[model samples]
Target: MPALPDPLPDPVAPVVPLGQDPGRAAADRLLGQELRRCREARGLTLRQVAPVIRGSVSKISRLERGESPPRPRDVRALAAFYEVDAQQMRVIERLLEHAQDAEWYEQFSDVTPGFLKRLIQLEGDAEEICVYENLVVPGILQTRAYARHMVRAVMPSAEPEEVDRVVELRAERQLRLMDGPLPRVVALLEESILHRRCGDAQVMHEQLKHLLHAGDTDKVSIRILKMSREWGVTPPYPITHLKFSNGEQSELAYVEHINGANYVTKPRALDDYRNALSNLRNAAASKDESIDLILKAQHRFGDRTAS
Candidate 1:
């Protein structure tokens, strides 16, 4: 079996769930996986295919692992090496081109492989982000220290270098909202998110201060769904929505537990999460009150709240 990625690490920063339509990415993933299978079926290993492609075993390994794109030359070489027909190679090459043009995220192949990088690009390019958090702050609101702690928590086995890379990637992801015409951001969080301290008190304080600023921004909103409210119906799950400038929208969600993570992207699967966020808006504290809640959380850090 492919090695399982490290368990759900605490996010260094909050990432609004980006529901990427994985049609092409899925197809590309299948292409790469299929290519690997074809080569294996031919009783050839990377060592065997290396000379034909004028590459090393590691390059072949990367292609098979879906850690990198299969170059056209590499694809043609491998296809010829595997005796695959021209028609199949054409399709694979097209997918490979799309993969190379990835626009969203690039640093998380360890956590997300192959076409997933492309999906992240589409999500990052979204015009609006609607997120519902069951626990903790969103990535955009997390301070660097808190974000690093979160990534490290679930990746205890990751090499120090890998952990730092993930932390750096998380920080980069958080920079999206600051650029371009700022996207609309609507975030709903369970009250407990305010209490969880993934980092030192100072880190939490900085995070809270950032959240307070976000709440005041016209482009951003952070709302709290406190436990004290008498919510008539419990939300079935967490959900996130990404809307494009053209009005295209997609919802993505996932749940994490002791077993691992179960991602949800289907429309029917995502409805409850969206609804839950909607319900929290009416049930939780007001937007203004939520801002105050975040202020209180940040104030817990020290005498100087914002600096």
Candidate 2:
């Protein structure tokens, strides 16, 4: 039970690079979460952990929230204090390295909101993504026209250039669904969203066709909640759940609004979202039925275009 050096030895080079990468920042966040979990489990407060790293309480808090990248030395000191085994220490070091690397999304910083930047970081690492949409199509599944129209509709004052960048950002996110082990995606859409017109008839028609195509993917599941089926409830607004790969199997819930967004980490709140999603799934039309609905909507839009 000896104390490690307050400040671990500094490296010859800078700990953080010149560029900012949310993906790398996300790694730092994961490291911080693990550190915080360890400290709390050992019944240690931030004040006590601070001295071990020769830092302040706020630093400990920030590290835990993954607000900033952690120093390798500080991570090691924390592992020692937490009695983390040697095997996990290596993983922490690797995460620190990855935190310094640049991510593709960094290029879109101009148009990306702060909350969305963090969400993107989380999404990149998530193994499963569950989304519920009532207002519009989820960005991950949106076609280019659909995304552009939705973006412009929501932010009419946004410059055309900015609108284009936001559309590009959405397209960039879709790449994750294509790459690596495709994260299992379960999306529940309100039946009305299919009928809501974003752009012209042609745009809605293309979007619906795209939805059908996306649903065909083995990893993607799309279901629609019909208006006729009374669930005795108004389903909650858009909810996104991200499940990460870590020893603890952590999950984060994201709820977005016009003013801002909320990132929920509390177990109870997450459980509530999970249960609500379950109910919505239960009330939704079967996958085949949902596809049928999508096709019908597509044909309806096609007729509008023809007329």
Top candidate by lDDT? 2
Q: Among all windows of ten consecutive residues in candidate 1, which has the lowest summed lDDT?
A: 1-10
Q: List the residue pairs that clash in candidate 1.
A: 9-154, 10-150, 12-147, 13-139, 14-138, 14-139, 15-139, 104-121
What is candidate 2's lDDT per residue for 244-270, written digit by digit as tens? 776354786777776667776666666
TM-score list, all predictions: 0.59, 0.67
Give per-residue CA lDDT, model 1, range 109-199, as digits (tens): 6665433343356455567777777766776667778878887887878888887777776676667555444467888888777888887
Runs in model 1 deviating more than 4 A are 1-101, 111-119, 233-237, 247-267, 305-307
lDDT of 1: 0.65
Name the lDDT value of residue 195 in candidate 1. Answer: 80
- Top of the candidates by TM-score: 2
Candidate 1 RMSD computed on C-alpha atoms after optimal superposition onto the true structure? 12.6
Per-model clash counts, in order, read 8, 1
